[model samples]
Target: MTTINDIAKLANVSRSTVSRHLNKNGYVSQEAQERIDKVIQETSYLPSQSAKSLRTKKTGVIGVILPKISTETASRVVDGINQMLQENDYQMLLTQTSLDKDKEIAFIKLLQSRNVDGVILLGTNTDEALVNEIQKADVPVVVLGQNMPSTTSISYPDYNATVEMITYMLENGYRDISFIGVPEDDPAVGILRKKAYIDTLKKYNLPILEERMAFGDFSIESGYDAMQTIMMHSSQPNAVFVVTDNMAVGAMQYLKENHYSIPKDIGMATTGVSRLSKYIEPVLTTIDFQNEDAGIAITRLLMEKLNGYNKTKKLTHTYRRLSGNSL
Candidate 1:
């Protein structure tokens, strides 16, 4: 019910002075600011976001496009984003694509139409069309998880982390380590992770066998099916390195159903050091990508762009290896 006009009259100042005090733009005398603050506190007055946006061309909100909202990675990253955004008086508008690449493209346009100040994409693949759209969009966009050459991104050290993990496996005497991974369409988890797995094996003079690799869709059932296919080979693997913790759990589930004892009959390791990985049976040896830190970094980078410091930035985050009984 209280408007800026009412506040100006009550504070004994011109409406323009009240505007400067409310918007924190231009200059207001210290005494006038004090009187306006007192009147605002007494009236519990709130500024209209629409009016502020009209004046500043910013909605005071950020749009986030997630591949899937149900995963531990998504939750942790969102928590970190919220922590930073709240401190800056910004709100978040979240949308889930359920891992649909087409939906990912659609949501970018949708968020832009909604007048979001910026967008943070929890990316999957770097499709050319998507990249071109990002290049042309009026709003600044930051990609997470996957790298795009000309865009601002906060990506994990997927290649190095996988190499480190595979090296650790080899050092522990896992010679015939089969990989359960998703398709190469997802450059971060699929292509890069698999490339590291193979390169590390070759570095140690290990055989590159076709039967030892299986592809999945980053699902538990897919992991189970991949494990089944891998087991059909005459020379079964002694260890398995899965691209994701979710898939690793799926593989473990299959191993259990077939009466295979973990670390005794077979060893396992995965990325994403999810909470469930620590609590699962036999525990999972995994890589902690520090997903929350990636979230915070992306938010800050987008904020910088919104503040007119526009340039392409690519930041690679670090990871930690979690020791567990599974390996």
Candidate 2:
């Protein structure tokens, strides 16, 4: 309930003097500064965010738009962003679009209306209209985990990385591989991984069997269902490369319940290896994408843009692989 006026009256100074001292924008006599500090400590008066933003045009807030941040990978990305923003004294406003294009656009517009200093978008596919809108607003928008033209972006080498892994598997004498993946129609999640699977098969002169490729919803349940269907086939794959660790775990559970030995009976590998992977029977042989680094880098770029220091058209992020037991 204490206002600047109350502090000014108690200190016998103008409200402007108190405001300057609080913002560190101007100096005050030692006695006046001491009195103001004492009054502030006693009253615990905090400035209104709206009023401060109105005066400085810097809200000290950043917006993060993610697609299904509940997942382990997405959560790690959020943690990285939070750590960086906390260090920089900026708060985060998070929204999940569930990978819906319309919802994502709406969220971006809403954040813009709120005058957020910057925005970091996760798992976004390029859209020219969206890029144009972001550019016209003169707001710094950093796209994370996907490449986009005409905007700053940080992306992992997902397609090529998968291709490399699959190539390695084939060269090492693994055949009859089943790829459990999300639907390719979903550009942000499935297209890249599916493409890698198909391309690698073609490069190695392997028969691309329609029955061998199964689509899932990137969930453990979906993975279980897909694996069940694959098992029903007359010929089973010798190895399975699941696109996500969650799905891989589900597949492994199904295999275990059905008494299908792991690695001994069939080989398995997945994209991410979280804590659960180690405890799981065969310990997933997966690639560590370093999602936390991606998150930190994106936040840093957003902060730079917020501070008016970044003037680049685009930025890209890369990834590394971590080998484990299942492969």
Candidate 3:
């Protein structure tokens, strides 16, 4: 275990000088810095992370709290965050809250206790307490996927975007439309998409049928179940809009298994245009949410916050729509 004392003795400088040089908090002369650098290289001395964190109040680690990490979209966002963090020599500490309000609040406190430089909350559940906690802590907290009051966030237009897709479907002469989405309790749930679906139908004076709506967890299995439920209805919808690609894929699988022809039998559309969507037979019609770009934007914003830029009052990020084959 090589310590700063060993390097200092070898470099013929005081330990304080070595500490200042390694931490980059205090400056030393060029000659002394070079000597310390040479000794550090020769001795293979690595400074203690705890000591560094104490000196700079920066752990060189970012906390990423996601609502439901098992989802494909969340996984892709994590990938993008990793790519950027690796390039910047930063590390990510991931925490999954499973959309539990109590768990999310506890996670925030835990992140703060761990002394993370900042935190990126992937999504918000129904609790507003976390926003106050973030503000009181005076730490940089950036919300992704969902908006928060009195905090900075990167948001997607789930409501308007879904309406746009549904409008397109209606215009295409698809009358009997059904929506598959997550439970309304989850903040990041597909309420917006479902709302858009209902709103569009109402604007056109279409009857709102209770059997046309189905709620499930955001999973392929749930999508399959929802689709089955919708199909069991006396008057099945001619077209369906699934809130997520994962569920849409599942619905497609169920349709295929039942020997139903896509587009010919029933049209399909969904949000999120992942790679899996393309290889499917009809090539799902979806709105590309640009998840990767959103991840990059959120990470960049986190960096800006770390660099002392205030974004609490500004809405700095938004989303774009991608029209794909499934629609």
Candidate 4:
């Protein structure tokens, strides 16, 4: 219930002195700062953000737009962002698209309208219209997952992760590998990942057959269906590589039902499902993109921009391969 005014009166300082000390907008004497700090500690006073925003034109809130809230990857990233934001006394305003591309753009505009300090987008694709909208927003925007040209982004090494994962499978005698990926529109999980798979096969002189390729949405059901289709191929792949661990779980579910022994019958490896993959029997081999670390890095970039520090256009994080029994 204590106000800045009460703090100022108790500290025996003018309101402007207290404002200067709290806002860092102007100078306050060291003597005045000591008194204000003492009073604040004793009173446990919190400033009115609305009143502060009126003076500084800042909401102290960062808008986060996610492709979907249900996914573990998205949730982990948001958790990291929240960790950083809270440390800096900034709040997050979250918007979920439920994997709808149109909503991604719409939420960007909505966040701008709400006068957020900045935006952190858990991007899926780099649509031109979406890019233009971000540029026009006149606020700092940092994207996670997808890497788009002419924009700031925090991204995983998708291509490398895929290559390493596929290569590991190949090294373990998996020549004919089936891939379950999202549509090509998703640059990170789709285009980059699939490209790595195809390129890796070519490197090893393995034929990239049409039957082994299956595309699906970011869902368990889609992965299940993709695996079913792959099974129908007369010459099915000896091993399967999925873009995400969530899909891998679905594929494994199908394999379990059909009595297919993992690694012995069909090896399975995936990317970015570290949390879920460990609990499943015969643990899943996956590339750890460090989603939480990616989230933390993106928030750091946003904070750099917000604080008038050096704005990094794009930042990349390394990926590590986790060995499991499934591969």
Best candidate per lDDT, number? 1
Give a tens-digit lDDT track for model 4, residues 1-327: 998889989999998899999988898989999999999999889899999999999999999999888898988888899999999999999999988888888999899889999999999889899888877777888888878667888778989889888989988988889999999878888899999999999999989898898878988889899999999989977899999999999999999898999988999999876567789977999888788888888999899888797445887887888898997
- Which regions of candidate 2 fall more than 4 Å away from where they truly are? 1-45, 186-188
The Cα local distance difference test for each model comes to 0.91, 0.82, 0.82, 0.88
Estimate TM-scores for all models: 0.95, 0.86, 0.86, 0.96
Error of 1 at 249 (Å): 1.2
lDDT of 3 by residue, 1-327 (tens): 998889989999999998888767787999999999998888788888878877887889999998788877888888888888887768999999886767777877899898888888876553557777777764688888776777778777888888888899999899999889987765554566788889999999999998988877778999999999999989898899899988998998888899888888899988887777778778887887777777887888888888888856435344555655555
Worst 10 residues of 4 by lDDT: 309-318
For model 2, state the Cα shift of residue 131 in Å. Answer: 2.9
Model 2, TM vs. native: 0.86
C-alpha lDDT (0 to 100) for residue 49 of candidate 2? 80
Query: Residue 220 error for model 2, in Å?
Result: 1.1
Relative to the true structure, candidate 3 reaches a TM of 0.86
Candidate 1's residue-wise lDDT over 1-327, tens digit each?
A: 999999999999999999988888889999999999999999999999999999988899999999988888999999889887997789999999988898888999999999998999999989998999899888999999988879999788999999999999999999999999888878999899999999999999999898999988877789889998999899899999999988898899999999999999999999987777777889999999888887888899998998899879998988899988998
Least accurate 10 contiguous residues by lDDT in model 3: 311-320
In model 1, residue pairs whose N, Cα or C atoms come closer than 3 Å (at least 3 residues apart or on different chains), thus clashing, are none
Candidate 1 lowest-lDDT run of ten: 272-281
Give the CA lDDT, 0 to 100, for residue 321 in model 2: 68
| Model 4: lDDT to the true structure | 0.88
